[model samples]
Target: MCLLIAIIIYFLFILFLSTLLYPMPVNDSGITRYRTIPWTTLILILINTVIFVAWIGPDMYTQEAGASGTVEYGPSPDYMGKINYYGFRETTLHEGIGVAAFTTFTAMFMHADIWHLFGNMMYLWTFGRRVEDACGSSRFLLFYLLSGVIANVGSVVVTPKLDDIPSIGASGAIAGVMGAYLFLFPGTSVNCLWGIGSLIRLPIAVVQLVTSQQAKFWRWTVSVPAWMLLIWFVISSFIPSVETIRSDQDTVGVNHLAHLAGFFAALTIFLFVRKDLFLRYLQGRSL
Candidate 1:
């Protein structure tokens, strides 16, 4: 919610400032579902903006709570408890439901700081459009939300209780896009500004960065090609490295498990959701 608001306010600020300074209009959509831009995109953005504002607004319902405990805000004396991912204390307006599941989805659009939002949004802006185009708006929404859910569940499964830190970001769902793309459209090209490191063990990273080539991963790997990236990602999910990602908080840190889960979810749903279409397509190709 906070991320959405920041973007809205930022867009308005740009529009107002630009018009006042130069009298120029910002980018306008030239196409839509009928006469206007798709409502799904607009609604998603609006919801994000509303949530963002609510998150930062003065606490009217609860007060700040502990990081490893619960937080309360507001003056009406209303208090609904909240917990961070690792079981630490946090603050929010929602209650009665599993904060765990809520955070699983809600956390995707949240950020602990400006840099976090910047990175996630950058990727979202880059990949979201293409994913929507390929999968259709409604399916994209389902893919995104479900992938996040899978990732969140994966995170919970591997983490110990009392690690109250909350994990939030759009990366898991985005990764699902990459995974799905590897399967559904192998001929599609993806341009990544990836860079690797030096001659040492870390140099491998640099080498990867230097050798990074933009290509249709689907085209590159022919036999069960799409599964390649998914396999690699799944392997990384169980790594214990994220368990120690941050020392300051007791929360389960990186949640690589969630990421792997997103990829599988994407693959599963993409293959099974439209069974009739998939089967018909298969029959059509079998000739």
Candidate 2:
């Protein structure tokens, strides 16, 4: 049920974004151009991957019998609990802030599962390269860490009482990369896969009735402008942050407030330090 609700919410959010900012022309042969090898982004991805492999392992699927006599599926509970010791907790908001300061940086490198690591790395690679090019590698690394720290702080501020739950993942820092990407490459295009293969799969009977041959599922890649994609992401995170605050739920899940905070932090930093890049994009000059 939770998975269903999450899928529905994600689908609706994507639909809404599509309506607001339709994808650009399909560029099957478009190539990514970078001024420098995004060493920082690559290093970040490598570090995160190594940590996950060393500690969390690749297998995220686990099952157990539930009270309803049905199998419940989720990540390994033991690993999740173990990782909390390394993740950022709300108790770090005040009295323990000094002692737990290390967790702010450590949590950005930790992930709960393969999917979590892959998704964050994918976004980081997609957006981090451009931002690194704009700000140079050293500054980019500083920006990424700062954004993540600020994001962790934001999460603590929003859920000060929910200290027992630990938040982990590099998404907050990746969100900052995306925020920087929006300004650095406003006119650039991003490739995204869209489909409904997982939402509704027809049974063999229905498939046979529809066609003699077996149904082959597929998804198409569409290219969208950078600004539109980043804006959609920011808005998506913002809505959830607001909803989470309103409901005051004690769920240890995606930290949307952290994502939002990281995004805004990077945006502010970019504006202050690299305003020229933004102005160049606005003036219709490609970087």
Candidate 3:
């Protein structure tokens, strides 16, 4: 519902902006090679959906007390996976570790809630189309897993608490996708969305909702570049800082630093594979 409204408002904004910025020419340098769905993305969507439907349901959030300790995990309603109780974090420890490493890349299929899975899947379907279309099947597929690994590691680095608290969701790796997308196509148009009200997403409005989100955030804040936010959000992880600690309920904010790091990592690969081509492209832009 919110995504739909955001799309409309975004188009309107693009209509208005078209008066100034022309749509960049579309490029299909790797058309055939990039046509496959990045496997990592598909795997993540599957994992999240499967997990939500299969192993862990909302009921899993309950009290499991033993000689060891009392674990209480009520249904964690947040899609971003910041459950407030001890049991909420405890119940998913093993699962979280599995995801932290690249081995459980399939875990992307699992989601903590319906809404959470919905948002991640929708984003994957949207931006993922081009990524898979450009990078080729194998690279695109691995890119997601690679990015996810960096994102999880970034979370671990920034929020040591996640070592114990069971953190789930694809936002970290998604950040990596966002990172790679921007690197491959810096000026690419994308949708920029934000919270206008409860259950409402105000489209910052642009041809590309993704780019718009990056531009708007960076334009407003100088210290953090749009690219950096990709990593910063990931680095921040599920743990709330002094700023967010006041919130009474679970809060799984986006991990920014991981997104940035993963993006750079993939970009490094891109550079290695197509150094001359990339340099020429940059030189052309400078000219």
Q: Number of the top candidate by lDDT?
A: 2
Tens digit of per-residue lDDT, candidate 3, span 1-287: 99999988986566345322221111212332324545655665676677677655644465546566867555535433433222223224445532233333443444556656666776565456566655555666677766666655554454554445444566555656665655655444443332221112234334345765555432211121333433444345423443333443235453344344455556543632234445745676510
Tens-place lDDT digits, model 1, residues 1-287: 99999999997665444333211211111121223233444455445445444652232244567777877544432112222432211222134335533566667765443444444454454445544544566877788777776766555555545234456666677667656655554443333222110112344445666688742222111122333434554666645435533333333445565566666666754543344545644675410
lDDT string for model 2 (88-189, tens) is 886654457533768889899988776677668877877777677777778889999989998888866876665657888998888877777665566777
User: TM-score for every candidate vs. truth?
Assistant: 0.50, 0.70, 0.51
Where does candidate 2 clash, by residue pair? none
User: How many residue pairs clash in all the candidates, one count each?
Assistant: 37, 0, 36
Q: What C-alpha lDDT, on a 0 to 100 scale, does residue 230 get in candidate 2?
A: 77
Candidate 3 RMSD to the correct structure: 11.7
User: Which scores higher on TM-score, 2 or 3?
Assistant: 2
Segments of candidate 3 deviating more than 4 angstroms: 1-44, 58-73, 76-107, 191-266, 269-287
Candidate 1 wrongly placed segments (more than 4 Å) = 1-101, 194-252, 271-287
